[model samples]
Target: MFFNRKNLEDHDLRHFYKKLLFPRLVEERMLTLLRQGKIGKWFSGIGQEAIAVGSTLALEDDEYILPMHRNLGVFTTRGIPLSRLAGQWVGKDSGFTKGRDRSFHFGSQEHKIIGMISHLGPQLAVADGIALAHKLKKENKVTLVYTGEGATSEGDFHEALNLASVWELPVIFLVENNGYGLSTPVSEQYRCANLVDRAVGYGMEGILIDGNNILEVYNAIDTIAQSIRQKPRPVLVECKTFRMRGHEEASGVKYVPPHLFDQWSALDPLLNFEKFLLKAQIFSDIEIQQIKTEQKAIVEQEISSAFIETEIQADIQRELNDVYASSVYTSKNNGPSKENSKRYIDTISDALNLAMERNDNLILMGQDIAEYGGAFKITDGFVAKFGKERIRNTPICESAIVGAALGLSINGYKSVVEMQFADFVSCGFNQIINNLAKTHYRWGEKADTVIRMPTGAGTGAGPFHSQSNEAWFTKTPGLKVVYPAFPDDAKGLLLAAIDDPNPVLYFEHKYLYRSLTGNCPEDYFHTEIGKARLVHEGDQCSIITYGLGVHWAIEFQEQHPEYSIDILDLRSLQPWDKQAVETTVEKTGRIVILHEDTLTCGFGAELSAYIAEHCFEYLDAPVMRCASLDTPIPMNKLLEDQFLAKARLGSTITKLLAY
Candidate 1:
């Protein structure tokens, strides 16, 4: 063992002095910076330094530390330079996020510490994924993630812990139970007497400890960390402590009763540890004083240096700096598909199997995805062919599943996540929107994975199961949205999306799974993403649509053979073929934007605005939009049909023609 009981139990004076005093130095310097207007807000871990500094001693330099917004001591223990932290606080390009984020909300992939998020619970699941990767690769490393006493109430917290226990992932969850969750007391949050009891239900070991005692925290964490590295299991350690300040420096902290506040202040970890060292004869008073002086001097010097480095001297904007990157694949499709090829679901399954066969780095994760083949039987035979390791049947945890996929992607694997239904995407919204989509732009980390969303209505699944959610992904930057219409495009685009370097939300219309058929090749074929397919070309009017809308527009074309019209199937929504929309609108001198989602703020809105802004002179009439009503999908078939029917769409088209 690199470190063992004797190493820590011996308690050398040098080690004790540094751990006890470093966090204190940081707290004082940060307060100074805040008073000087250099830092805007600070969440100091003044009282809970032991849990941060000592518990982290168990982890190696390479292991990931996913910490909270207030675990500044974790940064100090992990050897994150004080200057770099100061730079981040001051919004310098030299900071961890390159001026994109401030206040502990930053990380270095190189350091393996995930940047803390404002919504903090997601990191627990992300760390579980890293631990899963280590287990798969047979690496002797453990992952540690920290959360607050109150964060246990979050859905993500349970989602992560349950997954960790099921997988026996080598992760340590250090929950800082600091009496109060912001202003609310712990009694109001959970019915349980203690947070440690929650661990037994998940089938994991749990420990409760005094958070202020550095030696006790160090002993418990190091022992558990060693066992996890060898046996690979998660352990929950609850640190009972008190937050020495308000949630943030700007907070008034008026809610804290004066008597109770003084009680905790008297037990301040730093001051208590200092007296302990003196009594134990670990260090004389003058020797301990020297260590404190040296640590304070070092912190002050780093802060002074950071102030100068982060000061504004020139325009900070870098126009050429791209938030994301892309690649253009020249997809060559042979002349035509064989007649009577396959059904929509069959092609999707075939494409996924082929991709998995071709790329060993690819893996599938979702509830019921492995043995059951997913809710729609799309991945039915995958477990036998690929085994349970590659085709994972995750717990019914959407947030954890998606968050884990991001972690696997970061570890150099291409993960494909399946949401049983599109509407369920809302359950895992934080990881998709905040972490997976924005991590690249914020910290230069890539989430190279594909999220398969079974979208669209018509199967009588009602509101929760039926809905087109393309607009949500299209609206978020750094995420690509693809909704394939034909079987050929479905097979081809799925393969392309898997290969893309960014996170791609690939939406497959559930209603068309078996109803639609096309002549697509049996082998691997790539349909270039961000390119539109001109299904039928005409010069009278243009119908711009994708997915189910393609079939609707085709119905319009067949019914009205009198009008020369072009139907464009946009394969990708985020990078929809703008050039194709422009060309078709110019050639026809009229255009209609159509989608199955609600009319307000749909992807159609953006397309309509584009045509209005750029093609105003060429248009013979104002652009028309055909969309579903702004109401929840109904359970009854008649109401759902009335919501948006082909006959009504035809009538709207005829009216547009008359105008």
Candidate 2:
């Protein structure tokens, strides 16, 4: 039978002792590496071992863990090879990221562990997403996430708990209140009496426990996890503990009072557990020493072996391998061949409906997307077909939506997110730029997400509703930026973006949503990303543009029957069809860049710079650019009209031709 909290049986002691020993041994070995200058830095979780070891043991194999740097015990308890762990810290080729990323920023999908991004609070929201997936899939699994008390101050901490409670997700958000977040103490961080109590506001439960007590943590989690599996819900756990070391090995203990360390050291988990083993007659003092010795030997052996291991030299070519997935379409012609017709909005709706039908992993989420059918009624009748769970209507939380999408993508779900307006993407900018765009390159992490951004002006939605943000994302690597002009390309490109294995920002020009109509094939067809469509062929000059710019360029040619110019609609911005651009620019010996965004450092700047360097000899004149002024979009009718460059495109083209 089970005894009181703190006391463990003989077999429990055997398993428990290793948990206490492993992190400690690993910490000791890491300290040695720090002395030898082999490792750059180390975050010691010496006193907080119980929180990880206990919680890890309490959860099942399939349950996911999103651990921060301090949760070394979680790695050891989860059966991560000691060598792999040591190799990561030592910067060996055998590391989890193969020397690509720093230690503690690696995860194994096979092991059900999530690689944590530097911003720790975001991990909780990501864990909420993982738990959401488990619940939606009807899988009896839970997710566990670790964050410091100081990190609880981040908006994401509250956002995570709120989302979890709203959805009743099977997730446990553990706050290791180890007194400080780096150097900032908890007293300076929160005004609330206890962090766990905050969970009640989110319609969830909270448990505050002695985090240093391994048995207490284990007992709490073992029961909590079981209950969560049966009835899915978020649980907030506050584990009260202290940090024995400074933030890292190099960071001294000046901030910590000597007396405080002494007080905690006296109650050191390992020493206290040693005393319990001898007192409870679970293991003799001699046996306890033997366990420590064995654990130390293992950690030391791994560390020593890693020191001699060769590191894979950082290769520029290897880093670029998986930026975007391999091309899926084998085009009979250079561009897509359209047979049937559908409006741009219908194409978007049809493409999403078809994608959902084809791949069960694909999920659609946005504000008013469920029963409301979205703001523009683009996803009309989607909820009726796919049901509410798959076609989710989310709260107005762009950051959490994008953050959760990243987590879903990591778990092999082709997450399709809709930002109501492209201008509002700024609300989720941090998640997009930092978490979504960097995940793949930072930690060899998967970021299979499609963010639908309804972009552009001309309809007079003004600054907040009509600004084009495509230029911002094109600057970021590991991101596929798709901006289609015609309805056919919209359907085909959106489909391809859904199938893509990388993060894609699909810009759907809202102005063109109802305004533009063309022959969009009803049958299955995919427009290859990173390929420019030669909308109109001409030899005089090449007009490089995307989205609404393509329409403006074509209109410009119509107005001026004499100016012969080829309009190249670059559907994908990031890995743009540079070959076609090179071919056309060289053929015309002149180029005119047009865009809806401001002229300053726009996507046109990149093109102009490339043309200057790569196509220098072929250039007949300086590349001309026609774009909006470097100012926010105006609501005034005249100002908005002047803001758009469609009227002046003819002048710019004529000037370029004259040059």
On TM-score, the leading prediction is 2
Model 2 residue 87 CA deviation (Å) reads 1.6
Q: Which ten residues in a row have the lowest lDDT in candidate 2?
A: 1-10
Which RMSD does model 2 reach against the true structure? Answer: 2.3
lDDT of 1: 0.84
For each candidate, the alpha-carbon lDDT, in order, equals 0.84, 0.84
Q: RMSD to the native, candidate 1? A: 2.9
Q: Output the lDDT of residue 51, model 1.
A: 82
Q: List the candidate 2 regions with Cα displacement exceeding 4 Å.
A: 1-8, 325-327, 330-338
- Cα lDDT tens digits, model 1, 507-597, are 9999999998888887677888889999998987888999899999998788778888899999899778889899998898788888899
TM-scores for candidates 1 onward, in order:
0.94, 0.96
What is the C-alpha lDDT profile of model 2 across 359-382, one tens digit per residue? 898889899998888999988898
